[model samples]
Target: MTQIAINRPCPPRRRFGLSLLWDALSLHRQRRTLARLDTRALEDIGITREQAEAEAARPLWDAPEFWQK
Candidate 1:
């Protein structure tokens, strides 16, 4: 006996939406990590405490436009 398999393509709009969702989630995680970093760590990254705070304060969906692409 033989089995057959079928596959369906995902719509472009849905794919784009999923991409955006992923970007938002990634941004959220990164920001959280940034918020937890110590002053030394922030300094190592060359970002001041105020800059880190500002980045952490931004909404999850507030990523740069190029990130969506």
Candidate 2:
């Protein structure tokens, strides 16, 4: 097998603190907005109230870091 070197630049890393903060705030706002939506509106989006709540409860930093294998 031969190894090749590419000159492509790596993508910028996301700031964890900022990412976490933004995601948390977004989740909070989304939850509030979603709760106000009627069942018909939620059905149009193909998501249930339970699903939205669960998603909002997930930690923003749960994904693996892009730089890690």
Which prediction has the highest TM-score against the true structure? Answer: 1
After superposition on all C-alphas, the RMSD of every candidate to the true structure, in Å, is 5.7, 6.7
Q: Which tens-of-lDDT digit does each residue in 1-69 have in candidate 2?
A: 999898998987655787667766775677667777877898899999888667656564444354243
Q: Pick the candidate with the highest lDDT.
A: 1
* Candidate 2 clashes between residue pairs 3 or more apart in a chain or in different chains: none
The TM-score between candidate 2 and the true structure equals 0.50
RMSD of 2: 6.7
Name the weakest run of 10 consecutive residues (lDDT summed) in model 1: 10-19
Alpha-carbon lDDT of model 2: 0.69
Per-residue lDDT of 1 in model 1: 100
lDDT of each: 0.84, 0.69
